[model samples]
Target: MAIRDWPEGERPREKLLTLGAAALSDAELLAIFLRVGVKGRSAVDLARDLLSSFGGLRQLLEADRQRFCAEHGLGEAKFVQLQATLELSRRHLGSLLERDAALTSPTLVRRFLSAQLRHLDHEAFAALFLDTQHRVIRFEILSEGTLDSASVYPREVARRALARNAGAVIFAHNHPSGVAEPSDADRRITERLREALALFDIRVLDHFVIGDGEVISFAERGWL
Candidate 1:
């Protein structure tokens, strides 16, 4: 049956309005984005088929233009819309972080960093430069590398910190492998960054390794 034919409370849009977005399943949320379905399939049914084909929501969202457009019920228009939506979400999270001290809102920091780096197919090293008050100065991606490694230069990091007149920094990198565990190299680089920044009176607050569904913090592990 069409979504309109279903009970109003049971429809994805109605359920979202009533119980909130968190109450909806992945397919339901996707159905709302899809808006309509082709031929005999309902929007929810189409969403289910697309999710199954892509292996899950993340894969579907992260698919390249060619791959995403090749799928049934999707096209360049949908791809553009999806990308815009994802970017808006990231900017919203970033705006929230800008309103508070980074150290005081570790959860927001994690969410913002994850939103920035998680969707990348390759490894990326990023930093959140902060003022003496520990409020964010800026967020920048310093380097991007292969699927597993990104070359991070302490000197370049220190230079950026100096340029920003940052009092402190929180470093983060993403592992495309989906394992949040800090590798030996991760530890060494973070330590080097700490030592280099210390020379200029800039503190290294934490180093975070972002992976699929997890973010590991050096400070939390007592390593910072």
Candidate 2:
């Protein structure tokens, strides 16, 4: 049966409107994005099939254009729409960071950083430059490397911090290997960066190591 044929309270859109988006299943949220289904399937049914074929929602969202477009019930238009939606979500999270003190909103900071870096197949090193009041001055991906490691230079990081006139910075890097534990190299480099930036009166607030579903913080572990 079509989505419209379902009881009003049972409908994906109606249920979202009534209970809230968090109340919906992954398939239901995706069905709302799909808007309509092909041939005999309802939108929710098509969404479930797509999610299964893609190996779940994250895999589907991270799929390349060709792979995503090749799926049944999806094409260029849907790819464009999906990319736009993902970017909008990232920007919204970034905007929230810009408006708040980075230190005070550690959860938001982790979320924003996770959204920015977690999808990459390769490793990336990023920095969040903060003003005197600890508001975000800029967020930048300093370098990207192979799946295992990214080369981070203290001179380059210092240059950017000076350029941004940052009073403090929070460093982050992703382990594509999905291990949030900070390697010894991670600690050494963070210490080097902290020392280098201190010469310019800039503080290194924290270093975060992002994994698949976990984020490890240097400050939280009293490493800083």
Candidate 3:
């Protein structure tokens, strides 16, 4: 049946206007952009298929152009549209990172770190160096570890933090295993980071162990 043939109130486009986009299903939301579907399918069906194949919104957003284009009935024209839409959304979110805002709050710290380290497969230690006003001045990836701090360089981190004049630092690292718990080495490194940045008066506000869409805060646990 034509999409319009559905109960007028139940249709996505109509519902989006009347109730806002959040009221629609994921398939319905995608269909508005897709406009139509290929033979034997409607836009809703195609969107559901896409989400099913890709796992969900996160995986779909990260999917490569070739994979998206290769999907049944999806061609370069539609694939490019998809690509542009995804990139635009990503940039829009990234724009939220402010260079001079106070980040003394845990809510801001999670918002910044979660977006920065969402989909990595390996452990990456990064520093969000903030200015006096708490605005983000520099975001530096300090170390990449295979198993532990075997690869993280403390002296180098100190050097960069000093050079950047980072008034405060928020440390973030990822757990590829999807566990948000801090390991012994993680705590050790937090201690090391706490000591190293002290001479510069660079406060280590929090250390986050990010994994599987959740974040564990060392500060929140009274560890930092």
Which ranges of candidate 2 are over 4 A from the true structure? 146-150
Worst 10 residues of 3 by lDDT: 99-108
TM-score of every model?
0.96, 0.96, 0.84
Whole-structure CA lDDT of model 2: 0.93
Candidate 1 vs candidate 2, lDDT winner: 1
Q: 41-133 in candidate 1: lDDT tens per residue?
A: 999999999999999999999999999999989999999999999999999999999999998899999999999999998888999999999
Worst 10 residues of 1 by lDDT: 146-155
TM-score ranking of the models: 1, 2, 3
Instruction: List the candidates ranked by lDDT, beginning with the highest.
Output: 1, 2, 3
Cα deviation of 85 in candidate 1 (Å)? 0.2
Report the CA-based lDDT of candidate 1 relative to the real structure.
0.94
Error of 3 at 151 (Å): 1.8
What is the TM-score (0 to 1) of candidate 2?
A: 0.96
True-structure RMSD, every candidate: 1.6, 1.5, 2.6
Question: Per-residue lDDT tens digits of candidate 3, residues 131-202?
Answer: 777777877788876636567767888888889988888889989788889999889878887988887788
Each prediction's whole-model lDDT (CA): 0.94, 0.93, 0.78
lDDT of 2 by residue, 6-65 (tens): 999999999999999999999999999999998999999999999999999999999999
56: Cα error in model 2, Å: 1.3
